[model samples]
Target: MNKISESGVIGVDVHTIKSWIDQDDVVLVDVRETSEYDKEHIPGAMLLPMSKFDAEIFPKVLGKKVVLHCAVGKRSESAGKMLIDEGYLETVHMIGGIEAWKASGFATEVQITPPPSPSELKNQEPQFLCPTPGEVLRDEYMTPLSISNAELAGCIGVTEKDIEQLTQGESKVDVVLSLRLARYFSTAADFWVHLQIERDLEEARHEIGHTIREEISPRATASN
Candidate 1:
């Protein structure tokens, strides 16, 4: 309905977003948490929880505008800016979010699911970006199953000290460990590897993000 800035992201009414959705000209991303999303959400909006949002991981919205919306618009505005910062030429955020849409008599899809126990939620909830893979392993995977490092080591054919060191962040997740954990946890080995890589890259970014531009230059190609 109104332009908020010079950048591509702009505020639009629920009807405008609905029209874009109807025309299939926009990729709608709901930036609300999973709990809220599971209860009810815009019929076609893909859930990308703000708590775990990674701009780099925003879905492929090729040839279509990316529209973000939340419960009431604030999260969508922030998410829109995230797309802008990630070099999106233009982005749109629904001004009133699903709340406004519902107020306007728009239909929403609801997912039926059982609520998780509080302890389950505590164990499953991740620290945004999850500071370390070890923390993730200890808090999420291990504690939830009541598996001590010694037990996990025994089950996975690794030494107790190895598991201890890994959970302590004193060691890293290697191919062997990844495979072992994957087998024991019924997960992909790549999952552990990716977690380690994400942690390493996040630390690197924090350590040198600001200096990257000044320190590196694009290689020149030979003039034709």
Candidate 2:
């Protein structure tokens, strides 16, 4: 049995694999079936199922750092070892595969729909006014109420850059600031909710604002 070194075989979790995909430095090859690949996969992963590995597909990926993944980790590990033996110097495997990626709070392309249109946001209110006491509002209404760093700055009257660190998830949530947000959004919700749902809120608010701007901006003259 040929033992691969710990460092030699990079055991990446799915989140790191996603980062690698974004960078375009590595190639993700799923050694699963065509049916499996079509169902859902990492955005840029090439499908070279292990069943067809002996064919022309496997030879082309040689001399590159090949990150192998399957539904679970079992098949990928086996494929990684084979690639290493076949003279591919760098072979990494995603330890927990796609399921691990989702569990780590990383977004997946599967089952996601396009965001709502501008008209949708403009008609919607940021606050969820209660019809009955303690009733939970729809996810659509509650989701937009969360403030982003940009909106948070707007709420408290601060510069965009002043809250840039906060947007990046680096800054600590200030309790005083949280209280201020609750007041600004006209609710007593947690500050971290703002940080968590900031991006969604920003897009929704911007779209609504854009719709208003378009409606108000004067139409251009036909003749100069």
Candidate 3:
């Protein structure tokens, strides 16, 4: 099968992707909406919907190549750009997505299982990086439930801007918001607060360690 290229994105045929799948040498990602992904997708593909695609939060391919796709090729192309922009050296988008794959006599996987119960979610660590509370809210809850900003605000009794700001990371997750999110998403309020605390600590460590290390260096004392 022939490979196509456009706008810095590499498009490979379904057959080529299938070869990688058989070899298990590539990380396949589905970049469609949650509802669409819950309908059907390529087997072994992890769902990372485009609406909440955070390059920093995305799982790395490690030693393998990364392949992305949606219902068609367009969204995957965009996802490819995001990955490339974020320093992914080897990335490919499935040309024509599952549609072309099925048309070419390849099989697709249908999602028949419901989401795990809250008890099941307990004790499981997040699969991606330490994401912000807003990112978790957007991807895990709001997107999955198809809740619009206005709808969520109405249900939770907050302004739409409040919800928007939280999701955009422009505002911090406070006790009230945490309570609302916890109630709506079936998670603990501390889950939301701890996500913010962890992110803050990570940032502080990066900057604080550099400054303190330079000031306290043994070489500085020796020179003095």
Backbone atom clashes (below 3 Å) for every candidate? 1, 0, 0
Give Cα-based local distance difference scores for all models: 0.74, 0.55, 0.74
What does the lDDT read for residue 169 in candidate 1?
90
TM-score of 2: 0.42
Candidate 2, overall lDDT?
0.55
Write model 2 residue lDDT over 1-224, tens digit each, in one string: 12243324556777667777777767888775565676567777788765555422375654445688765554465466556666765677887666576677766555444766899877866531111110111111123345455665786776666566544444434556555544653433442343333434444555586887777877888996
Which portions of model 2 miss their true places by more than 4 Å? 1-8, 55-57, 60-64, 111-224
**Model 3 alpha-carbon miss at residue 205, Å:** 56
Where model 1 places Cα greater than 4 Å from the true spot, the runs are 5-8, 111-224
Q: What is candidate 1's local distance difference test score? A: 0.74
Selected candidate, larger TM-score, 1 vs 3? 3
lDDT string, candidate 3, 100-153, tens digits: 888899888776778878988885543322356787678756785688889999
